[model samples]
Structure formats: structure tokens, C-alpha cells
Target: MEHKPLDQLRSVADVQPRPLSREERLQRWIDLLETDPKRRLSSLGEIEYKPPAERALLREDDSPLTVAYEDPVLRADGLSSDRLGDAMRYFALSDGQAHYALCSCLSGRTMEAGTCAQRLRNATGNVAWESAVGAWLLAALAVSLPGLVYLLS
Candidate 1:
């Protein structure tokens, strides 16, 4: 006789642990960025902007992964004091925080970075959060383009 599918796959008493809180998830993302060698080097000072010739060489559809900036406060909170000093040297303030107000002034456009970060932090779902983060990042980059060019040159 064919055995009936298990009526109850899990016991009623078996409770799944709650999903990670937003803060925890953010921390996890921070930790991943911090630990990965490539990611750790992807922060502002470490990246070299591709030259226009090189950029033209790439396929139109090829997009590089955007690296998230390390949040200074998060690193300080997560690391031991000794490690914190070394870690601090490698990380930058949260990109949203650093560029939020500056971008608005530079671009003659107005949008608060802190507000975007807060909205991203408080977002209840992934899609909204991702969009908020992307908007803030792109705005900041746009405002900084001229400076970036000078620095790279």
C-alpha cells in the first residue's frame, strides 16, 4: 500500500525561530561586507573609476555590483576596541549619511539622506528598502561625479 504523505510534516510544538530583526539583518550585511576582502576594498578610497575608454569596452548590459559603504557606527558597535581602531581605518561612514545632505546642496536638488536611510532601515519589505537605498546612493554619486573625476585624474 502506498504510504499516505505525512499528515503533519512538523510537530505542532515545533516552532521556527523568528526571522532576524531589521537591525540584525543590517548588521549581518555589514559583517559580510567587512569580512570579505574584495568588499572591504570596494569602499570609497579604494575604488578606481573606470576610464571612459574602458567603460566603452564593456558590454552595455554589463553592470558592476555596487558596493555598500560601511557604516562607522555599526562597526564601532560591533567590534572590540582594539579591532575597532583598525577596522575604522578601513571603513567609511554610511554612504547615505555622508552624502545625504551634501548631494542635495551640490545638485540643487533636495532629498535628505538621513531620511532615506531611516526609511530604508524602517522599510517593512525588501523592495521598498532596496529602492530607497538605491535612490540615496545614486543621488550621492551623481552629486559627487565632478569631484570623483578630479580625484581620479
Candidate 2:
């Protein structure tokens, strides 16, 4: 007589599996589809995250975030502190075409920073906080010029 596996022949209560309810499954999916994106600035790397969730894309899984063919928000250029020199050059030499851009379209305001910033904003994305360093530079120039003229003349 051949000996069959105990699990196959006998009713062995070892593994227990439970299915999810329709509502629970639906909620799981809704959690996955919703994405929360934020921008971080520093000497570290920048990346978009789907974050941790208990849901998926559908009523089953979370959908992967899509990157546009020309997504400015997802600029892969070097954002490390080492790249600061290049970024400075970009700010000085170019009007604004090397840095990245970050904007919040829903805010009804748009940020016009550097090329890098623009890239962060998807090139077409709008931002609620529009900060420009150029204006400050111009203001500094104006503020100091009068003093220089007084001293020289």
C-alpha cells in the first residue's frame, strides 16, 4: 500500500484563509487610487512617493504613478548640494532655463522659479507659492546702487 500525504488524505487544519468583504475590498481600492505628492528641497535626492497604503489601484490594488514623456516634476538631474555651483551658474547666466519648477495647479497661483523648478512642476503645472529669487536680486542691485553713486560722486 502506498502512503498518501497526510495533508491530502486527512483533514488537516493547518492553513486558514479568509476572503475580504465587498465593502472592505472597495475601500482598499479607493485608498490605492488616491495619491499625495509633496516637494522636498535640500541636499538630498528628490522623489515622488505613492506612500504606504492598504489599498491598490482598483478595488484590489494601487496603481503605479505615471511619469509624462516630458514631466518637469520628475526631473532626474543632480539635485545634490554638489550641483549647487551649476545651479548658481544657471541662475546667473540664464534668464530661467536650467533649474526645475514646482507648482500646485489647484491653488490658482503659479511658481516661476528656475528651469529645475519648472521641471519639478511638470513644466505646465501651477503652484500656490510663487517665489522668485531674481526679483530679490534686482532689488538688491537697486538698493545698493544709490549708495555706490553717493560714495563715488
lDDT of each: 0.36, 0.30
| Regions of model 2 farther than 4 Å from truth | 1-64, 67-119, 122-131
Q: What lDDT does candidate 1 reach at residue 10?
A: 45
List model 2 lDDT by residue over 1-153, tens digit each.
Answer: 986676765575454334444333322322322222332222111211222131111110111112111223222322112132332232221212112231122222322222223353333223323334566778999999999999999
The clash numbers for all candidates, in the given order, read: 0, 25
Number of the top-ranking candidate, with TM-score as the measure: 1
Candidate no. 1 TM-score: 0.23
Please give, for residues 36-135, the per-residue lDDT of candidate 1 as tens digits. 4332121122112434344222221111112222444434444322221222223332434323212233323322333333333343236766888999
- lDDT score of model 2? 0.30
